[model samples]
Target chain A: MGERTIIPFGPQHPVLPEPLHLDLILEDEKVVGAVPSIGFVHRGLEKLVEKRDFNEMIYVIERICGICSFIHSQGYAQTIEGLMGVEIPARVKYLRTIWGELSRIHSHLLWLGLMADAYGFESLFMHCWRVREKILDIFEETTGGRVIFSVCKVGGLWKDIDNETLKRIVTVLKDVEKETKKMADVFTRDYTVQKRTRGVGVITYQEAIDLGAVGPTLRGSGVVQDMRTLGYAAYGDLVFEPIVEKDGDCYARTIVRVREISQSFDLIYQAINKIPDGEIDVKVKGNPNGEFLTRLEQPRGQVVYYAKGNGTKYLDRFRVRTPTFANIPPLLKMLPGADLADVPVLALSIDPCISCTER
Target chain B: MSYMPKSPWLVHYDASSCNGCDIEVLACLTPLYDVERFGILNIGNPKHADIFVVTGSVNEQNKSVIKNIYDQMPNPKVVVAVGACASSGGVFRECYNVQGGVDNVIPVDVYVPGCAARPEAIIDGVVQALGVLEGKYKNMVKVAK
Candidate 1:
């Protein structure tokens, strides 16, 4: 450990799904410091909201990133709806919860598969992805697209889910839960995965909170704070608790996600079972007139949406505090003092989505 | 003598993408439509890869890294451009940072088309790459045998 070596991990790496460049300062293959440079995928999405109308901005927000598209749109819509004093129908609230949780399942499964790939476990990667396809098929069946499901509208949802479709979704979710449990068992017990992930990136509960870490990353550190606990959307109707761990290691993060996927399954089932029958959306008679700040728990973490409308078709301003962006500081902290081999897995444990961060 | 199928390890590079396409690329390996059945594994190190899946349009900053990765991959490699941006610069075509499609920098073997391509399409593209791999392997076997 005489001289330090600096390695630029990626704005483009095979295992990572986003454009995040991490400069790792290594001392004899042990990381000493990590600096993250983002903004590779920034498309000025927040700025675009100023140009697009409040209604059209929903589409723009959905395009923020494909994996977290639904959450961004939902966060944006919730902010606007809050400002306008619009009460969404009960069925729509339940539908939003169902979709939100489904999106979480898909996202967590996606992350699990990528984590497996990063650790050189090709079989586990394949197994996780096979289950993810069922989720995507459900998305295609209910919404229109697989990735960017622009289904959530400002006032309500763009489309209504029928009882038959709801039943089918429930049936599919049951199968997904069974398969997800199998994968989770394997992921937790498998020697190679354990070797690669367990205790690799350990962040203390205090460090996680101080660094502004949210979602599973924070929960993995033994923090029980989840925006869903605030009871937005139909989460109020559902009875579930946030999944937490005390270890704050890569494995703990993995467990948090795996358990969260199961929780998402339950939430979706409950939403589907308790879904009411009513109009999906309400008509907005006038342009928005005030500023609203709203928060929602995305698959990654808590996403804050701030929107200001000046009683015009076009919004005055729109801003989003994405989870990946919030978690970066903590992620950087987790990288140092780890083996070079564990860099990718450690970075991925936070589930950094560069597009979301840069947006 | 029977020949073993070449397991083409993949190296994914995001030149200048918005990450929508990148997520879908990752989805190709998740439980939904696992590409690993065909031996498509994501390798972080470029030297170990047999295929380069370049997402996003080529940009000034990442162009050299893309070329370096393309050149570093062992012989008998294929490049699959996995989005409209990578294939034709889709929505970000005219941006100052974008240098058109990925083909502007590297020779792409297969093009998966979509705003952010679905995982199914990405798996299909990798399957198509196997055809290219088979052809290259046959050429190698003829030289050896």
Candidate 2:
């Protein structure tokens, strides 16, 4: 029998894009237990709502995490809109959906690249990011920022794309789809990738449900829980189904994200095709006087946003429950008994966004 | 300041950031903006790095980690603080835990300022650090004599 020893995993490691600390209690090469610690990137963003007005608060929320910035802003805007009982125009809904899907595609591709990098596939990582550049270009061209698109607002959206530009976006997405398909084939079939990821970290369906996992982590476990089905934005105007994979392993999570990229593309195409001509935003009047909760299906998982207004410009309380926060308990659950070598990949399988969690 | 090494190794460290800057730093390594063409490699170990490219603001929990990495780097090293948060704590300056920018913990040679500094700006910051590295190396040679 080997003596159990403790090893600190990180606040900084090579593969992790965000800061996270896990104290791994290891018995020889296998991890026996783990204690997770956060707050490294906590910016106290929720507290900022006290100072900034509801309309301006979207910027703060968007910066909660760069990768999930758009969705964060979207969720917050939608929540405040709901609170104020501001009914935005139909065109605004379609634009929001299109942009939301774009953000999802980019986020999923970024995760895919990071996943490849975790297993030491440098060339594959570069190739995945190369395709991601196209998506970023589209963001820069349309919304003016590659990472933080400050286009979402309280009433509706801050900007609109003409049908001609919308057609161009659809064209670019088609090209991105072609490139992504090639990468998907490599990810699903490559021997080395499969060897590293497949069956490496398995969480049963019951365990996922019990742990309250969300997003691809839960969907990967065969649970069809998707917040988009709740019909936020223009989702009700389009056909939608939650993508579910039966296997509860690292490979299943990977497949779920890969498949989602195509799903997002199709959703965007549908949105552009059905989008009608109308004003993008309505004049938002008065302050929100009640509390409302908004749920968004982010790239990683389901994020719940809660906003409490006091009939003033300033929000009384703003709280966010990011997907990574909900997935952390499940991450801890899966870590014990995993090989030390598998810790990085297992942690990444949840697509842990520490900034989002801490913020 | 004649000695500009053929290849400059950079170690990226995140103290407390939203990761907008960190991903942009990573983007510099990709095919589109491959800073590798400029003989820059993103190394993981601080001890082997010629430049310290830091993203994110300094915070109570990470200030020590930031200092540890800075002290570990070899002499003639230059530090580039990328993004507005790294330069002056940006939007998170008011947070309770945020101590300030990277300069609060270590001396900064170049400050690249942007909410999330663009990749081109980060690459330019690294290029600027090369000059600092050259100056520091020359000063070391002069001190030895």
Candidate 3:
């Protein structure tokens, strides 16, 4: 080792969306080892379930990560509904799926922009987010909130979309799909993007499983594990395969998100077309007496929520195991052999949502 | 306008946010909102930043970090606290680690309020911060005189 030096990567960095610090041990421009230090964005949200009632806790849980805010509420709503033995209407199920898929598309687009920025593609980053503005517009029109949408509640939704508006969203999404295709083509087919990403952070198929990776990180490594296959919401009725890449490098992971965006659009179309006309929610009578665990797919990976309610308004405990937490070990695995210059891109390939991880 | 030398360079720090306001802050930079037209530049180093934009509430661990970034910023600097969490610890105030609001640690010049402050609100806050920055510059000049 040619005079090893430990350099702190960040709690604050330009390329990173959230504060994720890593102490990278470098030897002659190559990263010899890396240790991640998180919690810069931690707000201790899970404990708030004790202070907030089960009905009200969805608001707090939803703030765990703004990118996946609706999905968190959806997962909480589903788990509590499970605990209370409440079955929502088919329409609500389909609506949740639609929103969740929209969320996925938005999130992946945001990641694509951030990843482009990471690799020093400024114009591409701007273009990607410009296309993303359309997605945000849809969110504002439907959910009423641009970022942290509080549309989801226990048992069902707080608001319902009219069939006409739902149809409008489909057309709007088609335009978004075209714009996204233009940008995603640059991501996949571009020479510089491939040069920066390909073989930079290679994780083998077996190593991915051994390190407990999830979402695109796992799927990118040739594993066909997607929590959507479990089908908690309207995903059961939807048909799509997990987009897998055998290369297991940064490029593979980026391509996985790009392909998933198209898949999300297709899923949303199916949900809106098959949506049933009925009451969105059922009446939830009492608080949950038992614990329930539910898994949901986020843009990054699988998020597992465990809630233990004590039959009171308040819950005994709430736990959110976000995908970034699971992806960190695999990140460390990727870092050792990488050039120190590639650290940011490699760290970003997992799309580290530090707030989600820390929360 | 005369007092201002160049467009303000910003240093943003996330103390203890949910990444809600953070993304909105970023949204301000992207092509649609495009704060760069106003000559605002987002930079990493605290020392070079003229406007220190903080998202999220003050927490025990990051209190020193906030202070360090604040201290490093030269005089005539303005602190814009974006989002409810940074303003008054919107939801996570009662949490053990949080101290509630950026003001608890550093003096805030602008408070942009929202659960996750919208980009428009964030831009408005920056515009407000520019005024605060000019006033501070005037004061610095007076002090020198």
Report residue A8 deviation for candidate 3 (angstroms).
0.6
TM-score, chain B, predicted structure 3: 0.96
lDDT of 1 at B11: 89
**A78 in model 2: Cα distance from truth in Å?**
0.4
lDDT of 3 by residue, B58-143 (tens): 87778888898899988879999999999999988888777899999999999999998999999999989888899888888889
Question: What are the TM-scores, per candidate, against the unseen true structure?
Answer: 0.87, 0.98, 0.99
The global C-alpha lDDT for each of the candidates, from Candidate 1 onward, is 0.82, 0.90, 0.90
* Model 1 Cα lDDT, one tens digit per residue, A1-359: 46999998877666666667988898998999988776566555576655578887887678777787888888888888998999988888888888888889988998898888788888887788778888888889888798888899889998888999888878777887888989999888988788888778888989998998998999999999999988999999899988999999999999999999988888887888788899999987788988999889999998888888899888888888889888888888877778898888888888987777775
Candidate 2: global Cα-lDDT?
0.90
For each candidate in turn, give its C-alpha RMSD to the true structure in angstroms: 3.8, 1.1, 1.0
DockQ of 1: 0.36
B1-145: candidate 1 lDDT, tens digit per residue: 1232446788888766767777777666655455667677777788888788988877666777789989998877889999888898776554455568888988999999987787778888887987887787778879988
Per-residue lDDT tens digits for candidate 3, residues A1-359, read 59999999988777776778999998989999998776677778787887889988888888888999999999999888888889899999998998899889989999998899998999998988888888889889988998799999898998899999999999999999999999989999999999999988999999999999999999999999999999879999988888999999999999999999999999999999999999977888977999899999988899998888888989998888999999999999999979988888999999988888887
Top-down TM-score ranking? 3, 2, 1
User: Comparing to the true complex, what docking class would candidate 3 get?
Assistant: medium
C-alpha displacement of B114 in model 1, angstroms? 1.8
Clashing pairs in 2: A215-A301
